[model samples]
Target: MNSIPWSISPSTRGWRYAIAVSTVVLVGLFLAQGADLVSEDNEMLLYLGTLVFAALYLGRGPTRAATVTSLFILNVGHIHPGFRIGFHKFQYVISFGIFLVLSEQIARLADNVRREAWQSEELYLFTQECARLTSPQKVLELLCQHARRYCGLELFASLAQIKGAPLQTPRGIYGWVTPAVQGNLLLDSLQAQTALALERIVQSERSRQASVLEATQKLQSTLINSISHDLQTPISSIRGSVDTLKTCELPDQDRQVLLDLASDQIARLQKLVQNILNLSKIEAGGLILCLRWISVEEMVAGVVEGFPAPARARIRWQVAEEIPEVQADFSLLSQLLSNLLDNALKFSQGPVAVEVSAGLNSVRLSVSDQGFGVAPTEREKIFERFYRGQTPRHVPGTGLGLNICLGIAELHHATLRVEALEPGSRFVLEMPRKQEVTHV
Candidate 1:
């Protein structure tokens, strides 16, 4: 109640009093014109209309003013003695007193209603504002601002890590709000609500942190397990070959074969590491393309020749006679082709067809292999990092190949997609032709 000032603005009070006086005077004159039909004793009864109006809108002061002015006007203008309170006017006095008491009670009730309405509106707006805020600090700041504006109280609200009660007032201050009686209750309720909201936000943040920690732990376990299994075979092969070379007097051809085997294993290790690094860079948003116009035929031929003899023998091509050059990063395009061809050869014994065709604005290079095509549900999932399918259990892979290829294609502004053929899976790379074609 202390937070709510009892007085209205002088200008507003003056306006309400003016309206009350004008209404009373007009109604009194109207009654005077009908004097013949009404008795002098009943004239005060008409003023009740003006008094009720004043009570509802004009508050106690203006309503009392209206009541006093109406009684004076009745005693002076309509009484038999005319402006004198004689013996016959005692009944009029009694009526005036009853009207005054009734008006005061009605005004008091209206004032209570008005104050409750104002408080309800302020609390509702505060709740809406709090709902829009995400941070606890912001909610506290808004709470303090509303306290100062609505309650006329300067509050100091802060989140503390103390034990004991939820709200503390160790300073022995009356309350956080002014006029310590009702204000204390209001402040207590508000503080408890704010504390509960803050606690809920804190609990939510803790849950989110726990979820992130659990995900990180799971990823760490998965990477360690996957890399360990993938890397162990090649590493053990290389170690065994090196040990044999060091301990045994093997034939020259056998030693050469072991050396080649070690070299191949080392190359495989390097490729695996490169794929992992590429994926990390892509995830970190650091993959940048060094694009240049390049001959599609030569790039595909070079990539095909880099494969092992048996793998190279499985590749066949039908490139267009005069395919236009595409703007792309050379090393990334090579890796993309390498991953596709490796995937095809790993899964099927049938020859892999490397087809390059020219369109009006783009060139398409597709590698199709006659293997069990990707499952309908697993088509898109296969392109996710470290995702492996159920088929080809005997094949060795880190499952980063297709994902890395997809990232490189995106960096080069190309599109990569997979389609299920009748007896094969076709992996297509469509690069926009940004340069003119030249006959070789």
Candidate 2:
């Protein structure tokens, strides 16, 4: 709607043509006074009608010109004594001239109002777009387009580390352009204000993101330091006791019990240290998968065979006999499978079930538990570290197992999904048939 072309001239070509035609009409009316078109007693009324036409079409200056010319032609051309140039006639012209100036001033004032309203509307839309934007160059492009809506403009953007300094563009990236090539300098001033505002906003937002990343990194470091320090004492004690037990003489039953307790404690301590260490590795982005071309059949068999004796009755496997070779780190794969199976055995009420499918050069493994199925709303939440489910507190488990398994699977380029079945819940691991090099 604002595309009304508010340019150097508010008067249109149509208005110019109308004014010319109106002037000719006024002149003709005077020349036609001999045809009884011009009146004697109604002279005031005739001039008043012409004055209204002047206000309607030609505005102030033209209105006053029309008045004076009409008066002169009425006396000279009409030869009417009443239309003569007298003191009263001059007074009427002066009054009519004032009215024309007042009308002109009103038109100019209204035009200013419309222009300001249009600028406000454009500014509002530009602000909304700016609110959702972050990247400096993208914002600059938008700024140029915003100006283009009002009129065409050029744009350039730059990023600086500090206030008012030139930016260091890596890989030949430039940040700034001049508006001179495509648009008015007025638009440049508008863009400069926009850039300055965006600069402030971008600075504030960048500072916020930087602060969050810094805090997270700091927390991770603190946890790693604390965990490392905490493990030293128990680890040393466990190693010392293990060595002493090798040489000490004791009864067979007592030695057996001591050995069992020692082994269990050692396993518990090892699990805690390892969980934190794996988390630390992931946080630092130092995780590497030592992929080796290995058979999925062997991987499945190894995981089943490695299960604890206490859960032997709960174990079930339907691994594919002709599983294809998959590239994976054996140790990490073993750990992931171990964690998934361990979780199933711990939470499941009836016997746990394992199903392995091989197809189209890919493999998928699913572990199902007959215990309570996870609620739909909590499914995603269960994958986060240290998240305990709705299970009773007495259950002997740490929440880190599933989270670690997910992290390890991701590192190996595999996908993990949890689905709720009618009688149980299932954990599925999927790996692509072919691998490709990663790109940044």
Candidate 3:
């Protein structure tokens, strides 16, 4: 009902009026050319063509223009008495004018539809962001606002991950809640799923935090219990044996054996301490390798030389003759090799074999044992900190050997994988072929 300002405002009535006027003009011309066949007194009937056109397209002004032109021509041609703008003409003119007015009103309806569509797009994007955005509270508020705009009705706004559930808003509960409390109505079949999904994201984060904390606490407890027992008995025996040797004059050969046993125990304790420190460094994300080009010969020889004779006798070799040098930290690389050999020997019933191979862009060193092999499913998860092979149950280990080996491998930008063998598991360390960077 509001007045439409005189502009090219969008109106279907305007479109209809323009169409109507064109129809009338074309029809009126046909009637004029066929004047002989048409009635002189009923000449105004020719303008009906213009009326129909005006009714469909043109507004009142244009329709009136067509009417005036039709009237003027009729008067000048002596086809009728001087101009007669009669009551009937006034009625037709007014009817067309009213039609123009109604078109403007219909335009407002069109505008409302356009506005609704625009708002819908905005709300859709907002809803999507609400689903994907970080911070569950912000997502909750966004969903609630969008739901209000979408259905023009809202019941509740909230996010549920572990604990807190905000309630009593406009949009009804879309199943994020436990549904125990009132106000979050469980509506049938709707698409506010993202809100519920947001809660799940929070739950996942909480679950991860809980698991990490538990693993850390477990590692700490295991280390304490293990260190106390592993170090205590060996140290006490070594001290008692040394004290006895100091008092009693024994044969040189017997004294050397006792000394060797004590030394081995001391070395074992030192290795455990070193492993603990290395594991701590890795957990803190501080593991770094002082990388250098070390020949494969050097790496293998170094690891073998450090091994006690009994262990070394059990190891066999299948290394390639022309083994290329690898970029690695010498100490860490040796430890990585040593850990693999130790794991192999510990698990193997008999001989352990080491093999080195090369591919297009990488080199692989594998240590295989004939012990009880690993299952395929456990291979990927074995690298996680303190994850032991076959769960060590009664065996004495901190379970940090493989994890420390992993950290060392990672520092060298290498990958470690466990391959299941028929008799045992083969551990492979693969690294990209290090290319020399020459200065320009």
Candidate 4:
């Protein structure tokens, strides 16, 4: 809007000319009233004053009218042989021409100054508005709208004309120019501001995407590292045991031992596979709860009984008689308890303790292992997928156990946390009390 021409239009010329004529007549009357104080030789000063005032305030067209009116007033009203300029003196003629040239130059200079100042103000406002906007499409649309509305210029924009390595954004690439005022500084500055804003938006999106990609890569690497040893070791053991039984005529006792070892390894493989599948199901958002109200004591006892005989011997339980039954998915709760027990056996040296208690609003189940406790810094890390703690390097695990436990707990709307005990670590699961389940 700032580029609007300062030139007087035909419609405005009539009023401006009238103002010029009125000012001239008024100045002449004032000079005549003070005629006794003013000399004929200094009469041109009054005429020159009117011209300068009009040029400064009313623009070039009005200034020209004032100059013409001055000449008529100077020759007819004040000069001798008033009605004709032919009788004017040589010095007076030279003075009149000089005044005409100087006044027109002043008007032209003033008009140029006005135009430059308006353009500067417009550029300032354009940049301020562009700075506030972050979206490219809105900037392009505003640019076009402002150009037409303010400057009366049509802005032509295209991606091809934009100079630089362009950004591919949801808003797409946009470049704009005021075709009629192609090399205008105001247009150039506006376009530059827009390009800078677009660059910032693109860089922000790229940075966000890079962070997500880095996290995904780290997760994939962790999963592969965890499963590689757990899967390979069990498969190799089972394969070697079977190969021995096939090749040699073994005694019955020896064959039985080999078969038992193979069966144990198979079981280990099956457990690892199940953990992997459960973790996948949780991550893929496919977990569904078949919630049931089951006796807390029975669930705890069953999980302990299902463990290997040696592990079962080391597990001690303290179940509160008043502990309330919990609402949970039966199978998922079983896996969750089994994982907690397995983790305690794998990490602890002394007997592990399973404690169940009830609060006013919730039931709490905790497994405490008497071993080297988790490091303070690694407390939260232990629950993350495939994250092995620093202390138990020799323990056989894929680091997926606790993560599976966490998922199962969440599905039942429960909380699982690890507390570093004085001499070991304690894992606690709390299930909130809810209304009786609607059977499905």
User: Which candidate ranks first by TM-score, i.e. highest?
Assistant: 1
Give one digit per residue, the lDDT tens place, for model 4 in 1-440: 34444344345677877887899999888876787888876778777888877887677888888998888877777775445655446887887788889889988887667666767787777777777786767777767776666655677654456543232335665454435355666565566666666666667778989998999998888888878877888889999999999999999999998897788788677777888888888878877777778888998888887776677899999998887777777778888998988888888879999999999999999999988789889888888877886845668897889989988887777899999888998999998866343311
Give the C-alpha miss distance for residue 217 in model 1, angstroms: 1.1
Give the alpha carbon lDDT tens digit for every residue of 41-147 in model 1. 56766788788888887777888888888877787777643567554746766876788899889888977787666666656666666666669888677767766
Instruction: Score candidate 3 by lDDT.
Output: 0.65
Badly placed stretches (over 4 Å) of model 4 are 1-190, 207-215, 243-260, 435-440
Q: Give each model a TM-score.
A: 0.74, 0.65, 0.60, 0.61
Which candidate leads the pack in lDDT? Answer: 4
Question: Which ranges of candidate 2 are over 4 A from the true structure?
Answer: 1-88, 135-248, 252-274, 396-398, 411-413, 421-424, 438-440
What's the lDDT for residue 19 in model 3? Answer: 57
Q: What is the per-residue lDDT of model 2 for residues 1-440, given as tens digits with 9 covering 90 to 100?
A: 23533221344545644563466456546646554655654654565566555545444445555555555655554544544554445655675466456545643554455455666666666666766776666666776666565654434444533232122232232234443343354454455545555665656887999999998797667556545554665567677667767888878886776676566557657666677677778767877777678777788788777554557668888876777788877777787787888788878768888888887866898888887788998888888765767967656555677888889877767789899988779999997656643211
Give the range of the ten consecutive residues with the poorest summed lDDT in model 1.
172-181
Q: Any idea how many clashes model 4 has? A: 2
Clashes of each: 0, 3, 22, 2
After the best TM-score superposition of candidate 4, give how far the Cα of residue 420 lies from its true spot, in angstroms.
1.6
Which regions in candidate 1 have their CA more than 4 angstroms from the true location?
1-21, 36-46, 51-98, 114-122, 144-197, 244-257, 347-349, 356-365, 370-372, 375-380, 389-393, 413-416, 428-440
Worst 10 residues of 3 by lDDT: 1-10
The C-alpha RMSD of each candidate to the native structure, in angstroms, is 6.5, 7.6, 10.5, 7.5
- Supply the global lDDT for candidate 1: 0.77
